[model samples]
Target: MMNYKIFIWMLIVPFVINGQNKISGNHSTQNLTCSTCHSCDIPTKENPCIKVCPRESMIRIDQPVTDAPKIFVINKIRETDIYSPVKFSHLAHAEMSGLAGGCRTCHHYNPPGNVIGCSDCHESSRKRTDISKPDLKGAYHQQCMNCHRAWSGSTDCTVCHELKGKEKSQTSVVSNNKKRIHPEIKTPDKISFAAKTKQGKLVTFYHNEHINLFSLECSDCHSNESCIKCHSTNKTASTKTISEKIKHKKCSSCHNTESNCSSCHSNSEAGGFNHKSVTGFDLSKFHSKLDCARCHTSKSGFKGLNNECKTCHGTWTLENFKHKSTGLVLDETHSELDCENCHKELSYSKPVCEDCHDDKSYPNNLPGKRAK
Candidate 1:
């Protein structure tokens, strides 16, 4: 009887090994390498050596808040609870997410196509076998509580959920939430920072000028910021305790913070950025409407550029050039001449008419009527 039992156990071991191999083969059909899910090259069924979710490598789709549903009724989790479903204002949170990390703040593992919900990745039931990640209810509370706690300094259940019996009509709640949107963030025109520097103390930053004139987006600087940065319940949260490097990190991206200290820092509050005063290139005449990127093409921030027409407008000729747009329309005779005939210099400054007529000169003897 003992010999027969040993032979039977040997046969069952091979079948169990084949079943494990078959399970692994099914995973291979999905075109995933061992490293995709496992940390080790050879993972066993008992110890798969599964890697934790790599959020940084995950592909995320960022859509406008207008594309998302305005409201979401969270009812799947609290079916048997005393509270009714929470009417979550999706649009309101998405709009505020612009300052933060966008959709990745909540949807950490979002891939291409439709935005997935927390329940898709996290198991809805608490009795789930995989205990590595949080359950659906835990995920919902974790994501919401972090920001809500900072903003209000409280994580009360009633803050989001409405008690089943004491709640208002569901129709009214859904209708009110649909129209919900984040309040417009007021932008400052300028901010004067008191810096501790030997060169200067006051650093006057033209805030609106960077947005309107420089064409910088909010995310360029505020991408890594948390909800506490803006929505903190404590109004007395001072930035004075922040390190010097942290304070200059944002400006260092565009400006030479290491060497050019006096450019920003000054003994007194400095005026707005002056192109002519700083770079000797007056943009008010021709390049006022142009974007900063139109001229500053280098990835290492704006560098000194040659102030010559040929540097940018290399293709400009008598036939293609529009003189009327320059506020001076040339006459039939002058129009026929090449650009170098009057404007001898590459700078394209005031025209010298002495090359043709000895007595005649620009501003006195008009080539053509000044364009209206």
Candidate 2:
């Protein structure tokens, strides 16, 4: 049946991809198409025919924890009322999930529109005939137990829920309930890795540059990380047995791993990413904070830019290019003067005044008036 669904989907792939000018709700920018989450060819507004398996649904979006509700009353299963509804601390759980997994920790199978709660998939009643998937009560307790049992080492139901009519136990002292987001992870400036390469043994990964400098979010790199990576006490990492090609899989997303062995690995420890060293363009002054995609502009990968102002901004004859954006607005005299008078180089990295005034050099001479 799955193969039949895929076969039918292939026929309408072109139309849904190009012909249909449709925008999915709350996920327009996501470019959510039929194939993104649906297995059926022509998914309608009434029925999307969403794939049950979350792994099969390729649209996994991890949203900020603050965006989620602070507290959710997991009282969907009211039939079995031996216990009161679980007052789930959503934000607290979200913050705790940060160390292990993001939203996927709970919302494992999110479609394009919104995250599907456990009640959506799991049946509310435990006495249901379908034993394939655990009922809602089973699903809820299982998810809660994974972490609660890990910490407490007991399956005590009171850890998450309180008995009926126990008003005092229903509400626990939660700290700053509204402000429930994961604390910003302190990124390391450099992380040295011992690579099993012939030439370069050490590779330094720049954790800080990727976040603050490159403007990469935590989710961009840590998409499907497991909780065991950090919290597991006895779980041994399986990286030792992995092949050389597989070793570079993590970095292959943005970097060229096959040919650039020496770029990352070396006899000594590798240094952090430097624009001057790699692209011959020093990003220290101006371009340090800009994302790599800003200048690269290519959706495929980051290639070197020409470094000339005209390369991106065409014919900057003084009126177009705003000097004020550079933190120092040019004065009338400096602005009026042709750029060639001061800047003689092909690139604007450094400007020289040798042509205009032999005695006056840049930084010493006031070619342009500093804007107040």
Candidate 3:
């Protein structure tokens, strides 16, 4: 009787395995053998050996929020539930993160691959054995509370979610999202810092121009900032006697804050950054939209680059140069002529036609017919 039963069981097991394989989905189609996350040969309800949290070296990679889902349905927490799934504003958080820490604010330990959700490392069950880290419920609240408390000064549960089925979670989500998110953070045009220094008392920071003209991201200048830094009601701050190096640490990365005291430090509130006035290079038309780092490649010291276009753009010759692209299509005769013939200085600034046509000059005379 035992021998006959064993033979029947062995025959039935193969068909069951075939049936499991028949189902096709992300989980079933995964290359992962059962052993990848489960140690048991045949995992079952009786004694399934499931892996712990963060089963392997977790992969994290930066992805634009545009690629990420705009809203995340966080309904993973199961047990005694008080509220419906929170309709998270994934895109709003991601867009706001650009000025803060980018996607790394929450996905800190993500390995370099697909972007994983918070539940990847944080187990959904709070009763699980992994006590080292917060469970999914705790992780979600923690991340949410950071900004929510800052935004409204309240951690009330209703602020983000609804009581199970009392209100339509979808309607509330749409209403909250449509109402207003973080108001447009107005960058200060000028920030007058009162410096306790003999060289100067006031240092005027050209806040908007740095963002508009220099093309600097808010994070580049204000990295590692917290909500308390801006939203704190207390206007007064504790005094700390910091060194000159410490005082200049943030600005030093882009400006020479050490010896060039006169440049920034003034008895009066100093003027904003002026390209032509300070560096003798007017960036009004050509380089107005460019970041400081574009031309000033050196991160340590923003040393000056040569005024010649060839300094950055390799040597330009008649064959490679496109005269028509300069808003002026060169005439047949001028097209064959060397650039230096008309552009005597060839500084790549306004060309001086007086070299050949002594009477003709740029803007007044046509190098070629006006590019229609």
Candidate 4:
């Protein structure tokens, strides 16, 4: 009989202890649990339930099922924390997402309804290594930065998180709160300017020069992954030194060799060589119009002859070619037409009546032939 009583007492003692462990609403000191924080229904350890929730739904834990009349009840505070509530800028961050949509990326599955907060996963303190909370400072820094580094944005320490014990005063917070807030606006003037260059060099790059003058787009020199992966101030950084990696790759690769220069800047008169080359066309433009084979096919790419058009055309003597019979010479109108337009099957062939009089006017001198 005593043995039976001992077993019963053992079970009764556990129940009593658990009853004491139940959270009391009167004490506001303790943090709210996963179940208490949200207003949505949840399962206890005794009974577990699962359901597929839509992404848009806001499932709260403790929201009352039935509505009741409310009254204004302000309680007097005994002691309160001095720390000012952080004015979170989730909306500001959302505007800067670029490609990735805002808040959903970092604040992952948390509580009863699986809506999340940083504190849900990264607790303040932990006993076991497997279930340890990220220390307060570490938690805030890591969570804010890891996402920024992954996305195509700045992850500078000074950009977002304020250093520990350096929190702003409540008076400052109040002053800031009173000021009218506005929507996030991009730094428009800096669009053409690269913000931070290598070595604190402050290279004032004109993106408009490459984009408008050279007919290039943002993607021409930069890949999506390249922009995000490069120039990071984090441990997982893949590349550093923007000059060696980004700038050199874009500029020097094509501009380095001499052979490539003469494709449009040849010395031959036949190719329209300019004695006053500087005034005629810049070296950059000369490079733009050149054919690849004109340089690459030559034995030494640099030794290719002048590109002047007169050099080649001068060989075909003007005296050797003329309009026969009537002896009419081509005026400015015909002179500017492409050589192949009238030359037909043979490039040097004499212009026939049909060649110049395709409109049934000239040569025949019919009704429409006379100048109006």
List the global CA lDDT of all models.
Answer: 0.81, 0.70, 0.73, 0.42
Candidate with the larger TM-score of 1 and 2? 1
The C-alpha stretches of model 3 lying farther than 4 A from their native spots are 1-60, 233-247, 280-301, 307-372
Per-residue error (Å), model 1, residue 370: 2.9
Ranking by TM-score: 1, 2, 3, 4
lDDT for each residue of candidate 3 in 1-372, tens digit (9 for 90 to 100) = 999999999999998687645534544544566666666677665555655534334434556678977778778888536777778788778766766666777776664557778887788988988577789889988887886687567778887777866867466677778554667887778888888777688888888887887677788877666565667534453244667777799888777776888787899876777788987878886777777778788766568889877777776778988877667898898888877767756366677777678687778888677776
Clashes of 4: 28
What is the C-alpha local distance difference test score of candidate 3? 0.73
Position 339, candidate 1: lDDT: 83
If candidate 4 were superposed on the true structure by all CA atoms, what would the RMSD be? 19.0
| Highest TM-score scorer | 1
Judge candidate 1 at residue 307 and give its lDDT: 87
Question: lDDT order of candidates, best first?
Answer: 1, 3, 2, 4
User: Which has the greatest lDDT?
Assistant: 1
Clashing pairs in 3: 59-110, 59-111, 60-110, 60-111, 60-112
Count of backbone clashes, every candidate in sequence = 0, 2, 5, 28
TM-score-better candidate, 2 vs 4: 2
Q: After superposition, how far is residue 11 of candidate 2 from its true place, in Å?
A: 31
Residue 10 shift from truth in candidate 3, angstroms: 28
TM-score of each: 0.83, 0.67, 0.64, 0.28
Residue 61, candidate 4: how far off, in angstroms? 26
